[model samples]
Target: MSIISLRSILDANKLSGNNFNDWYQNLRSVLMHEKLIDVIDKPANVAPQKGESNASALDAYAKYFEQSTTTKCIILASMSPELHRQNESMTPAHIIAHVKKMYESESRTSIHRISKSSFKIRI
Candidate 1:
């Protein structure tokens, strides 16, 4: 995607801490579109060790690093500043897992709103 389009996508779904479900779904869509979502499932040690010169291993590391960095940037850019600060040091996979663990449950206010709306029926 063009930079403009990517910026647009991130802006639309920018995570505000409580909107985890919507933000994560949008992130997945963007990553899938860029074919980078699989990076989140790979171990962070996919990086090659120094002087470990197997051609295939090096190639794998190169691809892994590219996908990891790109996906990481996308994930970070879509986050709130607070979340970005908290997760800045983690790998893409770890960041996703951390945030998912932290925010997967809808906030009480959100759940209450949904419940309230769902029951607002009139005869």
Candidate 2:
């Protein structure tokens, strides 16, 4: 286990739409620690088909399924109720993409505006 408590490591702060950058970084840290970041990035293929006989294939799909489910729970628990409701049906990967689309560009534009304004501040 990490020296840091899981609570601290996971940054219990929920994503309320105003803290996307911080929330994103925190999530990345947690996923990386769990070694499940790929579940949200690559999104492995669907579960093995019924009647599948290959033991390795079954094990691979099982691993992906377990990891994906854990990632989804983490993402959901870190979201505000409204955000969770909107994304609860989505897979972990889809939820991340949706959040990025909603906030990543917005944050960049906001930062640009802030920088421009700060450069002109009298104090």
lDDT string for model 1 (9-42, tens) is: 7787789878888788788888887788788865
Report how far off residue 103 is in candidate 1 (Å): 1.1
lDDT of 2: 0.85
Question: Per-residue CA lDDT of candidate 2, range 14-112, in tens?
Answer: 898878898998998888877888987784667677888999998888888888889999998888899999999999999999999999988888889
Pairs clashing within candidate 1: none
Instruction: Report the poorest 10 consecutive residues by lDDT, candidate 2.
Output: 2-11
Best by TM-score: 2
| Model 2, total clashes | 0
Q: Against the hidden reference, what TM-scores do the models get?
A: 0.80, 0.88
- Note the Cα lDDT for every prediction shown: 0.81, 0.85
Best by lDDT: 2
